[model samples]
Target: MKIDKGISLTKVELDRIEANFLAAWTGDNSTPFIVDAPISASLRTRGTAIVRQTNLYTLFQLCPTLATWAVLTPLAIDYGASNKNVYSHISVFTNKNFDDAQAREKLKERFRFAARRIGLPVVGNQPTELFFAPLGPARSQLPDMARAFVGAALHLGPPAVEDTPSARDWQRRAVATRCPNLTRLNATISFDRSAYCARRFEAWRRGNEPLTEAEALLFAAYDQAVIGFGRHRSDLVAPPRLFWNGFTLALEAEPSQSAQSIKLGPFPTQLPGGSQVAIRTPWPEKITWTAGSIAQDIEVAPASDEILVFDADSGVLLTRTALETKVIAVASERQVVIASEQFGVTSFGPSIQSADPGRFIAWTITGDELNFPGRLPPWDHITSRDGALDQCRLDRPRRNAYSFGVGWRVDPQNRSRCRRPNQNSPRTIR
Candidate 1:
């Protein structure tokens, strides 16, 4: 036999090299050295695995490869802007199987299962449905899962559902159930529909069926929540206005007309419990609000920390804060009089009596003095008919001041006070 030394290899040496290669391939490095060669090779292996998978089972068998692709594709592929590549791959896989529906259903079931584990909902059951459907233990329990999914989409946002026939059917059912008339009256301002709704309210008002105070308010407010009517133009619902009863009670306990004008410095701050907050508005009807989910109505008191007045159109988010609850008392139709002792700043501990009203009219009490006070009358003096004391007014002839204190003996009348605090005075009279 002609023996070629070059071709002759001992089993021991062959085995030794094979062992080292296998160790490296299996991610066991003999030394602490890192090699780019192995990483590139590993990526090639993953890419090939994704391309070669014939079915969901095989695809799952290559889960490590699939997961690797899932992470790298968003970076390596222009997948976010366009999902054509992934969709094409799925289509090809589905086509290879004789029954497309079965293949798709299997894939969806698996993929949705995975999505739910990661907090994302599955898109849909149909190929055309391009939106994601949220996963839930009882998502399918709803009368129409797809419609519930669509309604959830509208409410929460991010139309992750596919625009498939089944998804559309689901959306139709959901819309019919939740807000049957909302779609028909998308942006209507006419009171036609409101007038219809009012009939139900009129029934409730006429005692045909008793309603809770909140339910009644919601009924009336819903009728008024139109774009061109009732103080606002949007139909967004706001949370009920909130007033801490404990805080209001504290202010009520103080002497009458004991409107404490504490000024909170030049910033917003959370007041302690029992601080008075007085909100005001001209809507004539009281607004109901909920704090942290407990429903309550705004009240005319002084102990609440911060009063929020909601405009009827927009929901609670559009509520404006007021410095005081005092308004021009509607005692006579011919004229209106203002009241002194406005609510003070919420951010700091000073009243307008001690601090400048600042440039922010929103932050200042309504009756407080400012550079160009809106609708402000002038401030003047009025001699007490008893000839004992004098009162101040926002315009002239103090009509009302300290009805609970020294000025109480002067006039039972209430009017805005324009008395500038004496710069050198710092007396706290009991």
Candidate 2:
């Protein structure tokens, strides 16, 4: 009964069986395998292709992070530059690629994001003309494509577009938001001088005669865009106003300076003590003012530093030292409590005759010398209703005072001289 041993299945036969079984279970050409993954392998392959084949402009549209690498790669390979001191390439790429008016105007939205990331300086007045020559023939007309492009840009902040249109749009939005800090894109692009000069003269009744060529150019461009309406006479020609109608202009003059009559367009309710006005100086650009030559005083400096304090006469820089630097206000039966950095705190009562400084009142103080490891300073101390000087005192002088603990470092040269808060007052948590 030794029948011929059954022939073993050949490799081809085995493969055929496996294939047939798979087909029967899942259908031969059934929906192509689509295994879900975090990142699609197909997309990765496409992105690799884009990196190799895409142009510089298109590359930006696809991947903005490439901007860093693109500039780096060239300088690294050709100029032997390193990331530490390779600002030249960064500047060039940013200026040349991002600042092109025509390029930006086309991809305005994308350009806006790029400008923000790179921090472009602000130019006033003239609209940014991104394209020198039209992408198509109709340069003067606002094409549907351009409008759609702007709409799309507004929708997709950074991930979508990569041109000047985006940048200008962003700037407009920022200005509308009343954000004081603004940087311009394409700073090298000059402004329209005629429009700028006209607008400046209208506003201040003075010409920018002393402006340098560069400054003049920038101002000119800003005026043209903001005021000229890009050679059109439409309703959008005027620059956005920064003031509110019927707003009161208040003034509290310092005693040292003479009482001078102030003039603005239309006068609202007169500021009782004195109307507040801004005196802008030309050199170093300072602003200082006084109430009726003998009233309360406040002065802002050339460096834009401001000091608000009570003054019989704005004659000298007042300095008052206190036990705790954070004292704010003093309270008395008849007089109101007042606080100033220089005067500490004072209670002004009708009966009390002499003008004198008083005891420490409640206020907030920041501990500059507090060595807190892995922690930020108590900046939000102002939120505390009861004014308390936020001081950082140590429990054990040797333990937390000198060193904030295991993960702290004081300069080796000045380690001995470093002063730590003594155990007199404990670190106030509030």
Candidate 3:
């Protein structure tokens, strides 16, 4: 398909995708780890995870900040540069299994009509539909599961579902209809087909035990994760936990000597009598797990000795949210994360009700939404003022220095300001 147009559709697609990329510069030592920020074009973000000769998983973690455009632009070019005639990149997620050819064609027609209305091409490229095969006998659906997660990153806004009573009711029914158990995995220690690694991993995850084998591996070759698009992470020395006093969602951890992050549930559940909560990989850290029935798994490193807050409100993993609460710091080994005053796990668990045994993956829900499915995405809350892409900006201003307070940017001048990298926003996060 050749066209005499003002600009190539490929260029249009790249602009649209990059428009949603949110980034900001931080204070003096704000984001020291993103040292390659200036050279993201040459950044190698993906890796092969293997042992001996076994390819377990493909691991990649790319931040969505301005620097990341170096990586995305080429991929967009390649995709659009393909045999033109259809918008193969756009896809829909569904778990339905079609049985009849007639039904399939009808659905295809309907799908294409929707696509056309949205200005997408009708044919000549990859298949338009992405099917999430239902869990067969032993949960043979990791690839499908991973695709849902990766696909999820492409969308913005609440699902068409509303907060009305009927929506909540149906969502409740859906939740009750159990999805199969997430395959249990032990990426670390004594893992063999007959390794009993799952049982041992659970034991250690719940109750610390004296280990006889080599220190359990922190992650497995099958493990993989991607953190970006406004998400952030920090390390903590203590165990990660979500406890609630009703007034606020509280995170408390003790000081630990170990210098690594702890792995918590990719599984979700909240505390006793508290707002819905779950453990996630602390920010900046990413891992993909063959054992994960969901998107990715996290290991909280223990070096920083400060616990960071993660926002599950939007349903995206490890993204940032406003730290509106108070933090309190106490004596050695004892810390309270209330409100700086800045910053700062628990078991592999459900902390679940006894009545529900079949569910391994509990979702993150809000207090007022009444146990409905998750609404906000990790990046959805980030809104551009002009109601388009790239315009989303978070500008944080001055907080006094020396307090170790409100520092999140870097600049050429006072270096106290933060601005969205690629987007045209003067706002900074400090």
Highest-scoring model, lDDT: 1
Residues 221-320 of candidate 1 have per-residue lDDT tens digits of 4333331232221122221233323111111111112122221234322323334444323211233332222232333221222233222222112122
Query: Of the candidates shown, which would achieve the greatest TM-score relative to the real structure?
Result: 2
Candidate 2 residues lying further than 4 Å off, grouped into runs, are: 1-215, 229-430
Q: Write the per-residue lDDT of candidate 2 for residues 402-426, one digit (tens) a residue.
A: 1111212222222332233344443
Q: What is the alpha-carbon lDDT of model 1 when measured against the actual structure?
A: 0.28
Off by over 4 Å in 1: 1-99, 119-132, 135-237, 241-430
lDDT of 3 by residue, 17-104 (tens): 3232222123231221122112222222311001111111100111123222221222222332443222221111121333566645
Write the candidate numbers in order of decreasing TM-score.
2, 1, 3
Pitting candidate 1 against candidate 3, the one with the higher TM-score is: 1
Over 4 Å off, model 3? 1-106, 112-125, 128-139, 142-239, 242-250, 253-430
Give the C-alpha lDDT of model 2. Answer: 0.25
TM-score of each: 0.21, 0.22, 0.17
Between candidates 1 and 2, the lDDT winner: 1
Kindly indicate the candidate among 2 and 3 with the higher TM-score. Answer: 2
